[model samples]
Target: MTVDLVVRGARVLTSQFMVEGAGVAVQDGKIVALAKDPHLPEASQVVDADGKILMPGAIDAHAHIYDPDYTHREDWRSGSEAAAAGGVTLLIDMPLVLTVMPELARQKIEVGERESLVDFSLHAGMMTSEEHLRRMPELAEMGILSFKAFTTKPFLASYDYIEELLIRASELGGRIVVHSEDDQVIERGVHRVRDVEGRKDPLAHHDSRPPEAEVVAVARIIESVARVGGYYHVAHLNTARGAELVAHAKARGLRVTSETCVHYLVFTKDDVKRWGPYLKMTPPLRTKEDVRGLWEALLTGGVDMIATDHAPGTREEKEIGWDNIWEAWGGIPGVETLLPVSMSEGLRRWGIPPTVLCAALCANPAKAFGMYPRKGELAPGSDADLVVYDQNLEVEIKADRLHYKVGWTPYEGIVVRGWPVLVTVRGEVVAQDGEPVGRPGHGEFVRMGRWR
Candidate 1:
């Protein structure tokens, strides 16, 4: 049977191994076959990959597009456009506010379907109150099995609250994803830095959120979650001790998984002086040694996945931090640069194996988020979501070149390789040569069917 398309002459990174000269054929938006070119069936359209690396599209499971209310920072269209250009074909849009009810979650999903250029999944969030915790089953039935929780300021969910949330989610066959940091530890640090030390500099942002805060909170949560048979993930884990904690828990097979953002691997608290408030982020960049530890965890089996945590803020919001870092926005744009930076730093400099990188960027996240073979593998039944990377091509990153509504990037001026020359979602070309060619409405919200 003639297929819809075929991509030939590439190193295909399937879930198992990389084939040096591989060809993948697509029919009806699903991968129909993956083999060497001569073994593939005829297709209506054929594209030569020119011996580049063909990988399953990367998935950013921790994106904050902040849509519906905070589109000035980023919207679904801009966020997914950025994802498509960065070789990311899917996003798990974690909303800034709590969306507990299924009806509200469906409305947001419909919005994403109308505006996103790449496929996405929704996260029901901010598990703050008893009433909201009661709504977990509703979201789970909608194919959303992840609930958001926080240990620190704003959502300060008590251990009792978190434990109950974990229990309920476990009962519903769901996972709890938390922003881990000890509120008391952080409060003490803030008092020490701002009140006691009287420091308002950019470094104060780093100092106010010390590694101990992360380590303490992670330890507490892991110990608590492990006892109740709760499956939870540490979002944006950035500390050396924190990585070790996850590694140890994983060794025991206690149903723990964690993700580290691309930024944590590349920068440290030291770089805070260079960029000032621009370097500011929650769970601030850790020490050089901490960055090293995170790399080891990532290359090993300790860290389950890599995420963009792709939160962006405008320049005006960041510039004010020069005077008072407390006021500057705490996030930076990352979705558009995720793959390039990852390949350049992780694969090129650190010698990370392509297979391991693929696991971190693709398979593992999909498996955790319940998207699995359809979104992660390069098998016959998988969605035709893939990227053809020009591994040798290099481009310097600039804010103007990005599609973020904020018009800025923390990675500005760094040159990166393995930029996507072609990106596809469901057998359709969505981006080519660093530009988004797909229409906004081309995307559909993928329902994650939980297998476990």
Candidate 2:
């Protein structure tokens, strides 16, 4: 049968291994075949990827696009444009700037369907109220994949509230993703450090949210989930102790999983000192030893996925913490650098396997959130979302060249070895040469099926 597009002569990464001299054929926006046979079906467009790497487009499971509100920092259009430029075909948006109740989730879905340049999904946010908990099943029926909860300030849920939420979600066959940081620990730590002589320094931010806060909260969540019996995911896990807790929970078959962002895997507290508030993030960067332990976790399957946690804020918003560490926004723009940085550091620098990269950035996330086979596989019948990466291509990252509305990157001036030269979402080329060619409103909202 004739096909619409053909990608040939590349090191194609499948769920199992990378196959050389292989070809992937697409027809009607779905992958039809992957083979090395010379008698492959004819196609209208053939891409020669002789010296490149072909894999399923990355799926960023955690990002904040802040649509409908907080557009000054980022909108769905700009966020998806940055995702396309970074080789991310799909991103699961967190609900922070926009309310993620049933009505608001529908509104954000409408915005994404009308303005995003790449595929997207929304997570329902959980608040510490009986009214909010009562709406969990309704929101789940409305097609949200998981509920997001926070254990720290401004959004903290009490232990009893979290336990009830987990039980409710378990009853409805839904999953919960948690921002794991103990509010009590952080509050006490902040009080202890707030009057210190160096409290205004960036390092003080790290001290205020110590690694113990993460470990304590993660352990608490694991205990709650074990008793409640539901699928649980720890979002943006930063500390090695936290990773160890997740691994221990998994060993007991608690249906738990965790993710670590690119920044935590690549940067340390030293970067926070050098870049100041620009590098500041919640559950702040940890020590080099912590970084090493996280890398080891990724290699040994202790980490389930690698996401961007792509939250962006204007320079002015970040500068608020210059005089006092507690006043700055706590996120970094990363939707546009996830794949490049991961490849350079995870593969070239640390010797992580290519298959492992595919699993962490693509397959595992899809399976965790019930979007697998359709989004994470390169086999026949999967959606034809793919990325062509040129490993030898080195480019220095700069904010001016990025697509974030915030218009800056924490990774500026750092040269990364591999880069995504072309990205396609469902058989259509959405980005090329670090610029988005896809149109706004071309993106569609994705719904998740029941996941175990």
Candidate 3:
């Protein structure tokens, strides 16, 4: 039968099997059939993928678009463009340091919709006001997937407000994603570092915001969410101890889940030495033992999701000035490199399988963020979001080649073994051969719960 697009001559990774030399027929932006040797209709637009591996497009579960340093770092247009280039077809942007609260969340989402080259969602943030909580029901009804809460010092929402919102979200059946870092521990740690390191050393940053801070706050968050009977997700878990705490909670079946970023799993404190500023991020990277333990937990099914904590800051902000690590903005731009980096480091080096990659980068994240089949699956009737990858590929990452407005990646000079050669969103090729070809606004604001 004639179709809109037919991707022929590829190995399709499907739910059942990896079909060798498979051809996928697409009609109206949905996968219609997958066959060993599908007969291509005369009228259909056929694109030969040769022997590349066609897998479901990645869904980046966590990111920050429209951050404070938009022009200097990245805006929706550039970030989504980078996502396209990286084989990510769907991205959930966390509400950042934007001025407006929940009211402007929709406006910001609309702004992203106008510029996004791929499907996206906005994970809303919590503000310490009754005014914000009142909008929770409407936001959930509008299909905003989840709300983000900060429990630590720098970005704090009162425990009272957080609890109230958790209760409200429980009623709405929405998940609350928390940045779990204890306020007191972080405050004391920061102060202690200043006394010794004098705040001039960029290394003081990680020393201040230690893993113990994350563990304490994560435990509290789990307990609080359990008390409220609300589903909660721990974001950017940095240590194995933190993951163990989460595992213990899950063992009790408390509806608690957690995620760890690529940096935390691969890099550690010793690696943080020379790259001081570049190594900066909230819940900073931990020790070698921590990294090994976290990987073990991930393989053991103790971790729920993996997100690129892709926060970009300026080179000026990253430099070791008088303020240094204690005052430098904490973040690293990572959206563009998440897939290839994770695949190279996690799957290849650490023995994580393709199935785990599928779950963490595509299926599980889609389910967590309410995008599901429409965004993450390669099955019939799902959106034809796909990535054609050459596993034997090798590339040295250069900052100039990065697509984000940030124009650089913390992962510069790294050699990756696998990378995406082609990216298609809804049967339309958005990125090819390491560059984006898709136009802005081609992406739509994917309302959550629309495709369960």
Please write out the lDDT profile of model 3 over residues 208-233, one tens digit for every residue.
Answer: 88778888888877778678777788
The number of clashing residue pairs in each candidate reads: 0, 0, 0
Off by over 4 Å in 1: 98-100
Number of the top lDDT candidate: 1
Model 3, residue 179: distance off in Å is 0.3
lDDT of 3: 0.78
Candidate 3: regions farther than 4 A off: 14-17, 38-43, 67-69, 99-102, 320-323, 450-452
Candidate 1 per-residue lDDT over residues 204-283, each given as its tens digit: 98988888888898898888867887788899999878888988988888878899999999998888889998888887
Global lDDT of each candidate: 0.87, 0.86, 0.78
**Residue pairs in candidate 1 whose N, alpha carbon or C atoms collide under 3 angstroms:** none
Q: How do these models rank on TM-score, best leading?
A: 1, 2, 3
Ranking by lDDT: 1, 2, 3
Error of 3 at 41 (Å): 6.6
TM-score of each: 0.98, 0.97, 0.94
